[model samples]
Target: MLVGVLSDIHANRIALDAVLDDMPDVDAMVCAGDVVGYNPWPAECVDEMRSHDVPTVMGNHDRAVVTETGFGGNGMADAGVRYALDVLDDDRIEWLAGLPESRYCFDGRVRIVHGHPDDPNRYTYPSLFSARLLGEEDVLIMGHTHVQAHERFDEGIVLNPGSVGQPRDGEPTAAYALVDLEAMTVSERRVEYDIESVIEEIEAVGLPEATGARLRKGR
Candidate 1:
């Protein structure tokens, strides 16, 4: 089966649309989390994910914004995060509040998570132990650092699709991944979109102006 993977979509409809436009047909989608936070279109992003029937896990920023917690102050240093915190209504926050921290196979083969497999709150990337220690997993996917990576482990492969919004890799484009389950291979992809649109929304909502700048730089 073919699966499309997306992560850290802080809330950029433009990026999401661009990725989807170029994405190949797939049976399902797996999101590495952070569906909201550090972006101006949290509600729209959530709605789009739901519409696509994507399976998702929750990230640190998602937890903070959903619960009105302050843990995201560091992860959400970007202007978009601050804007999402201020403008996301109660209903929107509730949606994020309901997201799960981890998802995987019932038999212990495949797994999906935000951040690291060990600790979703602190770890930014998956560890070798997570794959080898987890025991016989076919594939493991995660995201947090907004940098694309593919690591081969003793047990399985660990991949990060990077950030759909708020990418900090000195590039303004959004990043994602495509996984061919049958082929047992994954590749990272970067897509260019209108960062200015996300910024405009942030500014229009009276969010932090720096939020707009982050989108342009992916940081």
Candidate 2:
């Protein structure tokens, strides 16, 4: 089966829409998490996920908004949580609240999580991936580092589709992945979006200016 993998969609509606429009047909889709955070359209982003019925795990930013535990002292992250809380209604917040830290989809052939399998908040970078990370599942999918990378082992695959919003991978543009489960291969993809419009919206929403600035640099 083919699957479109997504993660770290930090409330940037434009970026998410661009990625969705750019993606090819797949049997299913899964999000590693953070549907809301650090952008202008948390509500719309959440609704997009719900309407699509994409199986998603809870991200650190998602969890912070739900649990009232702010993201330590990161101003951008804290602002995002506050903005999402203020903008998202009960049902949307409830949906975010109900998300799990890790979940299995496609009949357990794939496992999805926001961070490491052992810890959701940990940033598991490409350099850290290994076969030891796999646990019975043919594929282990994770986000949180916002860097697009994948590794194939004799046992299984470990992948992070990358961040749909607020990519920190140094090379701008929204990131995603196409996973061919039967073929045991992954194809990472990137798409351009209207970053200026999102920047305008961020300022209009009164979020931190640096939040919008970083998208231009993708760092």
Poorest stretch of ten by lDDT in candidate 2: 64-73
Give each model's whole-structure lDDT: 0.75, 0.94
On lDDT, the candidate that comes out on top is: 2
lDDT of 1 at 154: 61
How far in Å is the alpha carbon of 58 misplaced in model 2?
A: 0.3
TM-scores for the candidates: 0.87, 0.98
**Pairs in clash, predicted candidate 2:** none
Model 2 lDDT per residue over 1-219, tens place: 899999999999999999999999999999999998999899999999999999999999999999877776899999999999999999999999899999999888999989899999899999999999999899999999999999999999999998999899996799999999899999999999999999999999999999999999989
Off by over 4 Å in 1: 71-91, 105-108, 125-134
